[model samples]
Target: LKAGVVEALKTVQYMGIPQMVVTSTRTEVALLKLARFNILSYFEDVLGGDQVSKGKPHPEPYITGANRLKVPTKNALVIEDSENGVKSGVAAGCMVLHMPDLINTKLEWNNVIYGALDSLESFPEWLSSKQFGMWV
Candidate 1:
């Protein structure tokens, strides 16, 4: 777990985006073990599920993330690969990008999704075009 977290931190750092690991109460202890591996400092904030009133698919987690970043919900971009995660991000009024990775499939899309990208590698071009207000 620690090695995985360390690799994840390195990846996120390579992308130049601030990253944090949000865990639920049942998994906080696991995070502690992960911290022992010295990867905790890579995250700006580490929140436990008990800290929020709701859980996944409820918007609270992502909402809390947006709050921590001091960014408006609408301006926040959520990259979720699960149906529940997509729903939660939408409920929080965030601009969500649905990536159907190994954990997700075509059946998950129900029309409410803003956009779907083929894979992570496609994000940079898509984001740039969207930022320029060109929906090509």
Candidate 2:
């Protein structure tokens, strides 16, 4: 997890927003990562590679994520840190917020991404404020 992500997750949870993790990694690995941060309880579920027939950039992971949450892809918000993740979310018809952690984007992502954040800590504010209808 990135810095302040635990707090962000807790804050979103406190606000009663449903959250789920969509990752290309295997389900067990993703779960272990969340467990390492002690944030497993914050998400409803993790839609991982084990659960998807395809990986990031294919939209299957994100589609599965929305399905697991019982929400439409258009209504889902994806906070991503990688290029493939962003592409996957966009292809899935979800709003993607990019926050660079390990990968620094180079291509023209603004046209595809819903928003860019300096840090994951700001996601809750963006969700709470007048961001894309302010989560109405």
Candidate 1 per-residue C-alpha lDDT over 17-63 given as tens digits, one digit per residue, 9 for 90 to 100: 66655455544774786578777777777666777889778989878
Model 1: colliding residue pairs: none
Q: Residue 70's C-alpha lDDT in candidate 1?
A: 73
Off by over 4 Å in 2: 131-136
- TM-scores of the models, in the order given: 0.62, 0.90
In TM-score terms, candidate 1 sits at 0.62
Q: Pick the candidate with the highest TM-score.
A: 2
Per-residue C-alpha lDDT of model 2 across residues 8-123, encoded as one tens digit per residue: 89778877778998878888999998998788999998877878788989998888888878888887888888888889999999988888885875469878778888897787
Q: What RMSD does model 1 have? A: 5.1
- The global C-alpha lDDT for each of the candidates, from Candidate 1 onward, is 0.67, 0.82
lDDT of 2: 0.82
